[model samples]
Target: MKKILFSLFLLGCSASFAHAHMFWVNVFESDAHQPPHAMVSMGWGHTLPMDDILTDPNSARIGVEKLELYDPALKKTDLIKIKSKITEAEVTNEHFDIFPADLAAQKIALKKDSLPGVYQIGAISKATCYTHYIDNKGRYRIKHKSKDELDNIKEIKGSLKNQSFAKAYITLGKWTNPKPLGHKLEIIPLTDLSNVHVGDMVGVKVLFYGEPQSTSLKNNIYITAGSNTFGLDEGFNLQSFLVEGKAQFRVQSKGQWIINTMKGEDVTKDGKLKDLYGKVDTVYHTASLTFNVK
Candidate 1:
């Protein structure tokens, strides 16, 4: 087995990191074989590769609801049955104020006879609801329940439901155009993954519920990306607003890269939220994609 090393960095106190968390998937080529198989891992936090541990307020592990891999021929392999190796590590660097974290990872072997093309791996997280309000005692409290289920609250600060979707591409022998696997929110790459090089303009499209997200000042999609070597430095990475559901960025360097975006909707008055979870304020939808550039 090949060892995976993670470097921990101090998370910047930005507005995005102050209140938001992201989930993404990382695909690594295994070093244990000649034609390396793919190794999949889940990342949760603001930074790339690794950051804060994934857990609820009660310390319960938060895991993906679905994990699947698609072959070049579109054959699906369910990876939910594979037992993941969960590991934990404590961040004790005095230079950086951080907390302990956990990682869930697994290795998967690809089909030897599969077609030589791009393979896709995707994951979806279970939806969870949280409510922030002031209790009758004049104290602020955050509960992992809908406002309708909480009692004795003096003021309802906010409430929201969050879920995430992630996808990564790996090329075996040759490059092939990959199709979206029907994620609620997905990032589809218009540029070839296997042949991406520095100075190449890469294009991508953002889709919501299988429809293109039209560009608008109030609802335009925001896309961000960073290289594994540089890390995710606020205001220093690639940031762009999608135009008519499409965005493009120039490759700056050669290395592994991750691109991600998020969309939040005010669904407090929506009929769907009223029927599913009463008194919900917002619904957050996030998506990410990882690939390597030469």
Candidate 2:
């Protein structure tokens, strides 16, 4: 029995490590006739720009909990409500067929006749919990629940609650630097995103809970960046440790690019499990920022 439990623990670790998927938001200009509108879609998987479509079942596990748009003047709009009012005709795109038949994308209209500047779109995903354990039947099991909520479990291997935030910038007429949206885990661009070009160094700052993430030798945070052209080619990507919560990457190619980072903390160490959900052993916070380079 002890040997079986050890094997189950190893299996749990492997499963957790395999689930390194990232979520990001993609923005595209609408058709020529559909003025003042942009088509927004969610990207999920290990690739940039677009990857696996968010099917209904997987979407329920890690779907957008809230979506919002900020105009150039910093006027906030609840995109969820706007998406319901607008029809598919209002924001039709020639590339709409590229998405799956059951695509969960949205069409958002910009402020009518508003000044031309950078607009920000952000999405926050619902928190999801995964628990790995051995059941009373001596079978290893992974369930979307916390260890504390499981029944008839012989041994608990691990549990994690994950939440992700995705952000993208859309330039209408003129380009402007975007301000941080105050996500729990956020990536803020320090360089001008609109003027980015190949071979240019783009700098960004990572903040956790509105504070810069520490980069001490003992607690270094690393950020990874990839381009749509590479598509899951890790060797072609860039990874660097943050210094004072800031890092920079040189543009290797021109296309859609995504920068993302994740941080995990033990909930039990801080009594967060007892004080908060009481269902997770650890919690992970992930953030991604997507942009286009000329």
Candidate 3:
């Protein structure tokens, strides 16, 4: 009986060794359009409750949690956990902090060649590694920080691209993570323009980044119709707006402005926009673009 029990213990240890998978994580912005800026963080959503781990040992154990990815349909595609370690002597593209063996982990990549939809991407030693999370239903929520701005959409008629068409500049509002109370778990900034005329094209150009301030960072922007919104996405680096109609306007020169038609609203009124809903405040830097009609 003793010999049989010893053999079983050896077999279990072997299985554990064979199944030792590395744990890791990849940080991403809530919006897919925005690029990822990674930091070793913990907590739910965009709120990083802690700073990155410094001081490397011979080996490190890193655990990835609350990871998320977005699909083209603007949905929380997947979420998963990756826990692993890295030896202090691994070479790679960027000289990032390497977790000593058993401490280094990589972001999982989605494998669509066999299975579709977002899924957990496992890693193999000495092979290309990409880590992704599993798909969850209630992991994400819709976050809009500027509902008052979205209310300022006005009608306009002008010559955009040397052609006559109806136009308007509308704000669809910004979404924040860690959703605030009275906010849906998943919110899409898309606006309904089913009543618009056919052949009309809408353009959505977004600018997001931390602006240098005397004391803190802020999100700022300049727009058409002599409108400017500064410190709008305060403490956050993600911004998304939806405009379903085309607008015709050009920079007259410096501060001067001229619009071909006189039928639009200054969305940012009183130099301030209201925060809608988000549980966790974020800090970010990015610029992105999206153009669509719906």
Candidate-wise lDDT, in order? 0.70, 0.71, 0.22
Compose the digit string of candidate 1's lDDT tens values, residues 142-249: 666778899999998767666789898778887777888999889999988777888898889999899888656678467877775554645346777787788988
lDDT tens readout by residue for model 2, 1-294: 533533443332222211356678888765466456778877776676655654423222355677888888888887742121112233346664332223346887766576688889888887877777778998877766777778999988777778899898877776667888989999988888866888999899999988888655555456778876643445345776788888998888888888888777666646645554557766778898988887
TM-score of every candidate relative to the true structure: 0.80, 0.79, 0.18
TM value for model 1: 0.80
lDDT of 3 by residue, 1-294 (tens): 423332332232222211111122222212233222222222211112222331223211223323343332234433333343333545545656444332223333332232322221111111111111111332211112222222222321110000011111111222222111111111111222222222333222221211111111221222222111111112212122223222222221221111111111122323222121221111111111111122
Candidate 1, poorest ten consecutive residues by summed lDDT: 1-10
Deviation in Å, model 1, residue 46 alpha carbon:
1.5
Task: Give me candidate 2's TM-score against the actual structure.
Answer: 0.79
TM-score-based ranking: 1, 2, 3
Q: What ranges in model 2 sit over 4 Å off?
A: 1-19, 30-36, 55-60, 81-103, 231-236, 269-278
The global Cα lDDT (0 to 1) of model 2 is: 0.71
Mark the regions of model 1 whose C-alpha exceeds 4 Å error after superposition.
1-19, 30-32, 56-62, 80-102, 234-236, 268-277
Where in model 3 is the C-alpha error above 4 Å? Answer: 1-66, 71-75, 81-204, 207-294
